[model samples]
Target: MKVHFIAIGGSAMHNLAIALHNKGFEITGSDDEIFEPSKSRLEKYGILPKEWGWYPEKLDTSFDAIILGMHARIDNPELLKAQELGLKIYSYPEYIYEQTKDKTRIVIGGSHGKTTTTSMVMHALKDNNIEFDYMVGAQIEGFETMVKLSQESKIAIFEGDEYLSSPIDRRPKFHLYHPHIALITGIAWDHINVFPTFENYLNQFEIFTQMIQENGSLIYFDEDEHIAKIIKNKREDIEYIPYHSHPFKIVDNCSILKTNKGEIPLEIFGEHNLQNLMGAFHICRKIGLSDESFYQSIQYFSGAAKRLQKLADKNSCTVFQDFAHSPSKLKATTEAVKKQFTNRKLIACMELHTFSSLKKEFLPHYKNTMGSADEAIVYFNPKTIEHKKLEPITKIQVAEAFGGNNVTVYTDSDQVITDLLEHDFNHTNVLLMSSGNFSGLNLIELAEKIVNKY
Candidate 1:
């Protein structure tokens, strides 16, 4: 199989290109810009283009398929050439579906916890020596690539994303998988540039639920009212399994689970994580993992990348960085850190980088989300807003919308870095949350700085 990728340097796209390359398929890709990690990884695979930028001349009738990334626009020359040739073009999700159509697809979808839940399932499966093809959103500790596709594996696990599939495909990526076993973690309105309204954003999930294979299973978080409503409307033939936070007890900053094989300690904690674990448990059970196997395997699970990931710790201070830009994710991450270290002060800072978070109308969803932090800080880049072609917003508006006197807002990246450096790190746990780099503030450096100050 020969696959040509447009905008191949994307996190997911590059991973998929590598996965296919490793499968002994001929892989070629082009992008105008390629960044670190993706560029290096692609180069290591010997598949990185000699030069960046699209070349329509590279498009040929001999190619098997063209997988398009969201980073590629509709007018991309390669895309236009592929269309002109009437060649097969697949969005990331569409191609994934085409590849895994014969397998029992298990898709984990929701506004939050998708990566963590997908990681939990993958951890359990891999630990138990279960062979499976998978695609997760983050670079997990043990996995070489974020995507792994094999002809031998009977099942495919996908971290279902609600974001648009591609420039040509307006549908959400999750809508294409149509999983045989699906899970919805929770719902919060996001992607304002696409959906525009909360109800429209939610309807995508509803559509996803409707797309589930007949007589298949739907595992959901019963605690979420929106998810409950979706599950309630499902067909009777489909199995509906709802899970809550897995039974666990915290002792001396350690989280132990009440398993069938007695109590077991876990490397990861947090109510949301426990909830994600429970959801993963149900999905794994349906897919043939025994309770004993799941429990034993989940013990070594570190967690997905950037979901409360421990960066640096020293002298009672721990620093974490999370990809928690949404309101629900922010609240959950803040609460998780606080709950885990009740004795220490929790200082949380998050960047408003996404389209929804920066939108004036969507700001209300963040009300009280960051209130759990002892000192909550919100940062927004005016340049980022301008770059995204969004309306200008003020720090005062953000602080007001979040509805907390304790909240500190900043627009300058250097100010945030300086403030973080000056803040008392002794006996405090720090969490830096954002989907972005906090406007180019280096997390590892910041984390080291925080840890060293203690």
Candidate 2:
């Protein structure tokens, strides 16, 4: 297979490029700008573009397919060349479908927990000696790349993102993957820039469920009210399996899952994690994994990168870093850490980085979301709002929106780092949550400083 990628330096695009390269396909990709990790990883595979900018002269009819990324504009030179030549083009998920169409596809989608749930299934399957192609949003410990594809594998697992696909293809990504097995962990309002409203955001999931292949199964979190409402319009052509949080107890700060045969100790702790685990378990079972094997493999699963990642533990203080910017994600991460470490002073710091979180209209959804944290610190760069071209907001509005006098807001990055380091972290636990780095704050370094490691 010969594939050319436009805007290939994207998180998903680069991984797919690497995966295809590994599959022995001739791969070539172009991007105007490529950052660390993506640039380095592509270079290691010997497929990194020598020139950064897209060139129309790089294209021809010899290419079997053109994969477009969301980062690329509709007028991208390479994309225009591909279209001019009338070559087939695929969005990230669209190409994934073309590659895995013959295989059983399991897509996990939700506003939250999809990455963790998808990672859990991938780790368990690989741990049990199962060969499978998979794609997840976050990196997993045992996996070398975020996207993997193989001819020998009979199943493919994907983290189904609801965000728009290519700039040209406005459809949500998950809509393209017609999954034989689909699981939605839960739903909450997010991506207000594209989705505009809760109903509009929700309609995408409804369309995704409807896109399931005939005789496919829909595994969902029954506890979510939005999901509950969706399942009301159930289909007879597919089987529906609803799951809730698996029975677990916090033991010695470790999460333990209760099973009929025995209790399994887990490295991950959180109610949302427990629910994610259950969602993964159901997907595993459908693929013929025994309950015993599932629990055994899952016991060793640490977590997907940046999802409740432990950064420091010393002097009776623990620091957790998570990719949680949405209100639901923020609420869940804060609650989980506080519940598990009830004795400690829970200081939660979050960055209002995403377009949704920075918007004035979306602020109210965050009301009381961080109440579990003993100290709630919110950070946002005013310039970020300007960059997004949004209406300017105030620290007062942010503080009030959180519905707490405890909620403190900051516009400066260094001040946040300074205050966190200055505070006495002894017998305290800190949760740093955001999709973006707190305006280039090195969180790992920050965590180490909190524990006196640096």
Candidate 3:
């Protein structure tokens, strides 16, 4: 297969390009800009574009398919050329569906825990020697690429993102993947830029549930009221399996699952994570994995990258960085760290990076989300807001939105670092939560400096 990618520098796009390249497909891609990791990874695969900008002259009917990424604008020249030629053009998710149509698709979808839940299922499948094609959002421990495609694998597991598939394709990414076994971890109103309203944001999941293949299974988290309501009215042809947080107890800072086999200790913790684990368990069971195998494999699962990932620890002070920008994720992550280290003071810092998080109307959703932290800090780069063309937001407005006297807001990344450094690190755990890099601050280095200070 010969495939050309437009805006191939995207995280998922580059990974898919590599996966297809490894499968011996002739891959070519173009992007206006390419950043680290994606740039280097693509170069290593010998599939990096010869130049940065799009070249419409390169587009022709010879290519098997043109995969489009969200980064590409609707007016992208290459996309126009593909359309002009009447060539097959696939949105990232659409192409994935086309490739995995023959396999049993297991899609994990929700506003939160999608990556972690998908990672858990992947780890379990691999540990049990189950060969499966998969596409997860995060770079997991055992996986070389976030996406892997093989003709031999009978199952395809996808981390079902609810975001728009492409600029031209308005459908949510998960909607394209009609999964035979689907799971919705939970839903909290997000992606306000696209959906605009809470009800509209929620309707995507409802559509996702309806998109499941006939007689397929719908696994969901029963604890979430919204998810529970969505599952209340279900199709009799589809199997509905509900899961709650797995029965577990925290023993000396470690969470051990109370399973029928025995008390199985896990490397990862948190109520949300336990719930994700339970969701993964049901998915694995449906895919023919034994309970014993799932338990044994899950014990080795630490977590997906940046999903409450521990960066550094020293002198009773630990530092963690999480990819949590949404209100529900921020709250759950902050509470998890605080719960895990009850003896320590929890200092939680998060960046209002996403379009939703930065919007004035959406800020109020974050009310009391960081209340679990002894000290809460919110950072937002004014330049970022301007770049995104969002309405200006002040530190006071952010503070008021969070509704906490303990919350401190910072506009400067350096100020945040300075403020954090000023604090004594003893008996304190620092949790840096954001979907961004805190405006270019190297978190690993920051974590090391904070840990070494103790």
Expressed as tens digits, the lDDT of each residue in 1-454 for candidate 2 is: 8999998899999999999999999999898999989999999999999988888997999999999989989888888888899999999899998899999999999999999999999989988999999889988998899999888999999999999988888999999999999999999988899999799998999999999999999999998999988889799999999998999988777788899969999999999999999999999999999999999899999998999999988878999999999999999999999999877899999999999999999899999999999999999999999999999999999999999767989999998887877788877999999999988988888888888843
Highest lDDT model number: 3
Residue 129 in model 3: shift from native, Å? 0.7
- Model 3's alpha-carbon lDDT is 0.94
Instruction: Sort the candidates on lDDT, descending order.
Output: 3, 2, 1
Candidate 1 least-lDDT 10 residues: 228-237
Kindly report which residue stretches of model 3 are placed more than 4 angstroms away from their true locations once superposed.
Answer: none
Per-candidate local distance difference test: 0.91, 0.93, 0.94
What lDDT score is found at residue 217 in candidate 2? Answer: 100
Give the 10-residue window scoring lowest on summed lDDT in candidate 3: 225-234
Task: Give the Cα error of residue 71 in candidate 1, in Å.
Answer: 0.8
RMSD of each: 1.1, 1.0, 0.8
